[model samples]
Every structure is written in C-alpha cells, then in structure tokens.
Target: MQGDVGFAQQILSLNLVPRKRLSSCGNDTSLCDFSEMWYGVILWTAVSSLIFHLPAALLALFTLRRHKVARFMPIAILLMGIIGPLTGGVLTSAAIAGVYKAAGKTMISLEALVFGVGQSFCIFVISFLRILATL
Candidate 1:
C-alpha cells in the first residue's frame, strides 16, 4: 500500500512536468544533458517559488490569521494576490477614467485589464499549486 502511494506520487510529479520538448544544446550528449535540464528546471521552480510566491503567501497567511481558517490560507493567498492587482487597477482606473474620457485616445478599459490579469493569474496560481502538490 505504501509502495502504491509512492508510485502514485511519482506519477503525479511526472505529470506535473512541462510537456514542451527541449532540444539538446550540444552534439554527442547523453543522459547528462537530460538530467541537467530537469535539474535546472526543478531548481528554477524551487527558486521562483521561494523568491516570488513564498513572501506573498506568507503575507496573505499573516493577514488571514485574523479572519480565516488555516486551510483556507493557500486559497486566500491566490485570491488576494489576484484581487490586490485588480483592485489597484480599478482604483487607478477610477482616478484616470475622466482623463481618458476627455482625451478620447485608445486605452484599455479598467475592466479589460482586471479580467486579463485575473485570467493569467489563475493559470499561474494553478501551476504553483501543482508544484506544491508534487513537493
């Protein structure tokens, strides 16, 4: 049973790997290149998670400590991370809408910016969640 669980975890980890193929950078290369590529990828994932996401998650968790369930912290971080940008954009837009309205120039609407950011943010957060699940 334990072995089965380990196998399932391994499968999940393998599935989480990006499907994009990377060509070898050198001629006459062997497993070393392939191994190195995956090593670099894993290292990059860890480094990015630590550098970009961890602090945000920590801040979200800290803020949520007052009014949230512990398990909801991760979801809260994802939501807060997204909402923070969107809210800022909305506030800025409300401030600038009049200027744009008067200028009659081409500029993205605040709703468009918020929606675009939200869609991209969801993809990013899902990928991070997958990475965490593997770990």
Candidate 2:
C-alpha cells in the first residue's frame, strides 16, 4: 500500500516538473540553460493564468447582476485563484517533463514545487488586485 502511494506520488511529481524547451540561448547543453528554460516555463504559466483570470473576472463582474450565484462570486474566484495555478502547474510541468523524459533527462521536482508555489502566489496577488480594481 505504501509502495502504491509512493508510486502515485512519483507520477504526480513527474507531471509537476516543467517541460523541456530551448533555453534563452537556444540550447540545452548546460545547467544555466536548464535554469533559463525553467524560468520561461514559470513565466509562461503565470502569464497564461493572468490572462485567463482577468477576463473571467470581468465577465463575472458584468454578469453578477443576473447570475443566481452572485453572492458566491468572491468565494468562487478565490477558490479558482488557488486552484487555477495548481492545475496549470500540473499541466505545464507534465508537458515539459514529458519532453525531457522523451529526451532521456530528468528534472528536479523540488525546483518544480518551489517555482509552482511562487507562480501561484504571483497569480493570486495580481488576480486579487485586478478583481478588487474591477469591483
């Protein structure tokens, strides 16, 4: 049972690591290259989440008057702000890890987790501010 749980965690970890892409210098031959690539992964996910959340927030604001769940908008948005980054993290990480794995390389999960949390925090701050401004 413990082994099964560990295996599941390992699978999740694999998906949480970032994908492989050309570093800022267009090469993946050094640790610096990998770091730069990871930064890009983080930035891409962060920006994507921001783009999605902003429009969603605006739409919710406009529809609040007619929606039955008007009162729940704040709570819902708050929840999604938390969940969105996590979902994005898993997806981006899995995609990147898949690429790296296909090329016979490994990414450190700890770095993934740290960057994911940082990304989530950044998204949360920007989203909160944008929503507050809209309201």
Candidate 3:
C-alpha cells in the first residue's frame, strides 16, 4: 500500500510540474489552424457588409429623391452604396490576412489584398466627396 501511494504521488507530481521554455516555433500543435477561420471571417464580413449597405443604399436613394439636399446627392448615394460595402469587405479581409501573416504562414493570398485595397480606395473617394459636399 505504501509503495502504491508513493507511485501515485510520483505520477501526480510529474503531471503537475509546469513545463518551462515553451517553444516559439511554428511546430506547436496546440495552435489553431487559422486558414478556415480566415475564410469564414472574410465571408461573413462580405455578407454583413452587403446586408448593412443594402438598407443604407435604399435610404440614401430615397433621401436624394425626396429631400434634394444637395446638387451632389447622386454622388453621395453612390459613395454610400459602393464605398460602404467595399470598405467593410476590405477591412474584414485585411484583418484575416493579417492573422494569416501573424501565424507564420508563408503564402499571403492576393484576393484579400485586392479586396482591402479596393475598399480603401472607395473609402478615400467617399470621404473626398463628402468633404466636397460640405464645402
């Protein structure tokens, strides 16, 4: 019985001992594979962007037709429709791509980069027009 207790204690101690100097290398098996996660995040982002922007686009169109707030109302509506969706899509894509890079993945896909750039450009143009409208 004493020998059995000692063996149990030894096993418990071994299990409880903290591991030191965890490896920083990519070989760690515990880390989640982010590839699928990235794809899901990007897809959801695109879908949500479309859903959110659809209603906003409709509202902008209605406002442009009814209120006649400014001569550049068409431009504003276009910006809201195109730029808003593009911005949201790109931001989400970039975030996923960034995670891919952080995970020591060697290949960064071009699709995400293109999406991000297109979205950023749309945002820039939208902001410019908004400023112009204000002026």
Candidate 4:
C-alpha cells in the first residue's frame, strides 16, 4: 500500500509539472505568433507600395519631355523623389523601432528597422518619381 501511494504521488507531480511547462511554452508560442503577424503586415505594406511605385517612377522618368514645364520639373521631381522617400523611410523605421520597443517586444531589432527603411525608401522614391513624371 505504501509503495502504491508513493507511485501515485509521483505520477501526480509529473502531471502537474507538464501542465505548467505546457502553459509556459504556449505563452511563448503566442508571442511568436503575434510577432510573425506584425512582421507579415509590414511586409505586405512594403510590397504593395513597391508594386504601385514602379510604373509611376518609370513614367515620370520617361515623360520629362512631354510638357513645357517638365524640363526643370524633372530635376525637381527627381530630387523630391529621392529625398522624400529617404526621409519618409527614416522616419518610418524610427517610428517602428520606437513603437515596438515601447511594447516590450523582442522581435523588433535594429536590423529589422534598417531593412524596413531600405524597403520603404525604395518604394517611396519609385512611386514619387512615377507620379511626378506624369505631371
């Protein structure tokens, strides 16, 4: 009877341990899932921006001779196209980093911010130039 009781207690303890462990693991997984979701959103936004910007930038570059105002317009547009995106990208990356850090999340790193800025800047410049070209 004594041995049986001891075995039962051991079994109960083992069961309890696994439950706690499982819960902790589940919480970690939840965090990871949220991080992945946020990252996905960022990626989608960046990709969409790129898709929209490409043709616009090309058009702007190609249409410089179409208008009487475009001779000087291309240079101004080119500068804005480059500078606007650069500034916007920097601002965006800084904002993302600040927000994620404030949220106490570990997934948002400096490297991610750098990557995001590069992607955003490229998209912005392309789109801006494209729109300007049409003008």
Candidate 5:
C-alpha cells in the first residue's frame, strides 16, 4: 500500500495536462468542455493496475518452475497480492485525507482507492480465467 501511495504521489507530481487542467471552462451555457481527463485517468488505472501486480505475477511465474510449490502457492500469491493492494489503497487514502484535514486542507485524495479498485478488477479477471481453465 505504501508503495502504491508513493507511486500515486509520483504520478500526481508529473502534472499531467488532463489532471492539471480539471474543469477549466466554467459555466458557459453554449460551450461544451468535454475534457479528456477520463481517458488519462483510465489509462493511468490500467497501467498502474498491471504494475501493482507485476511482482506477484513474476513470483507466480518463477514458482511455476517447482512442481510441488507450484500447485497452489502461485494462485494464493496472486490472490493475496490483489487483495493486499486494495486494502492498502483504501487505508492509505484515508490516512492521507486525515492528514490533509488536520492541516486544514479540504482536499481528499482518492488515487489510492482508484489504484486499488483497478488492481482488484485485474485479479477478478484472472481468477475468472483460472476458473474457466479448470473446467
């Protein structure tokens, strides 16, 4: 979770255009401001989701070399890897929000939550594939 929080902070610091220019065009009845922020956010979520699970995926791949250890450990590791990040993201977001509140800032950081949910989606898809593989 800490790692994920750090990663999010790094991304935030990049000052990406979409994120940096949120809802800039204010209340023009005729003009439509369809910002591509959603696209950037989606891209970020997808990439980060894969990256967050890369370690577990690598470990699972390596464990495949051993017969006995390979049987269940890989799947368990993958599942736990997915779950740990989700919980970590939630807790980290909350902690950061608390800190901001204490500092008299009204900002609420949801990057951790977004990253966690994105990774959770990846895990669900993988688990579904595994189920299909068994059948």
Candidate 6:
C-alpha cells in the first residue's frame, strides 16, 4: 500500500500541462486539451502497474512446480522483488520520456517519475522488512 502511495504521489505531483495552458484549455469548449493529459496519465498507470507486479507474477509461476525450488522460494521472492523495481526505474524513466517526448510536453519532468520509481522500491523493501520482522 505504501509503495503504491509513493507511486501515486509521484504521478499526481506531475503537471501534465502548465496551469497557463490548462486555464486556456478550460475556457475552450473542446476537450482535447485535458483529454491529452488523461491519455498520458493512463499510459503511465498501465505501464507502471504491469511493471510493478512482474516479480510477483514470476514467483507465482515458478512456485507452482512445488519442487526443489520451493525451499528457496522465500529468498528468491525477496531478491527478485528488490531487484525488479530497481531495473524498472530505468525502463519507467525511458517510457515516460518517450511519452512526454511524443506529446511535445514541457510541463512535466521525467525526473519525478525516476524519483517515484525509486521511492516505490524503497517502500517495497521497507514493507517487506516490516512483514519479515513481524514474523
């Protein structure tokens, strides 16, 4: 949940369009201005959601065999969960850059996405540590 919060905060803080542009668009009757922004956001949400769950998905598939691998499952999950997002940061940043670049966007910073990805990873590790501690 906390990892999700970091991601949400990161995405929410992004200004898809400058307030000046948004104000002008608001005055216009056409929805194109705001619609474009929502499109970018939706793209980000979709990519992030898929990337974040990748580790879990992989673990589930591997664990289904329930053989020798079962003994190392916990360690594998922990390592993969940690490493997955670390690698994801680069991919996320690149994807975000591509989307914004295509949009000719100047308002939003890709750095925010990078930071958000990092924070999400931190939150993931922290949450996992907390869970492990409780046990």
Best by lDDT: 2
Model 1 is weakest, by summed lDDT over 10 consecutive residues, at 25-34
Q: What TM-score would every model get versus the actual structure?
A: 0.31, 0.39, 0.34, 0.36, 0.37, 0.34
- lDDT comparison, 4 vs 6, better candidate: 6
Evaluate residue 42 in candidate 5 and report its C-alpha lDDT on the 0 to 100 scale: 39
Return the clash pairs for model 5, or none: none
**Deviation from native of the Cα of residue 93 in model 6, angstroms:** 16
How many Å off is the CA of 52 in candidate 6?
3.1
Index of the highest-TM-score prediction: 2
Candidate 1 TM-score, C-alpha based:
0.31
Deviation of model 2 at 30, angstroms: 11
Expressed as tens digits, the lDDT of each residue in 1-135 for candidate 5 is 555667655655554434433333442111112222233333444445556567766777786756775656656666665555455544543454455446643321244335435545765687679989999
Better TM-score candidate (2, 6):
2
Give the per-residue Cα lDDT of candidate 6 at 89.
47
Give residue 2's lDDT in candidate 2 (0 to 100). Answer: 47
Better of 5 and 6 by lDDT: 6
Please, what are the lDDT tens digits per residue for candidate 2 over residues 1-118?
5456675356434443243655433233222334433554564455456565666666777778577869568557645754775676656655664576567564444444445556
Q: lDDT scores for all predictions?
A: 0.44, 0.55, 0.49, 0.48, 0.48, 0.51
What lDDT does model 6 reach? 0.51
Between candidates 3 and 4, the lDDT winner: 3
CA deviation > 4 Å runs, candidate 4: 1-54, 66-68, 108-135
Model 5 misses residue 96 by how many Å?
0.8
Clashing pairs in 6: none
Better of 1 and 5 by lDDT: 5
Candidate 1 global lDDT: 0.44
Error of 1 at 108 (Å): 39
Model 3 lDDT on a 0 to 1 scale: 0.49
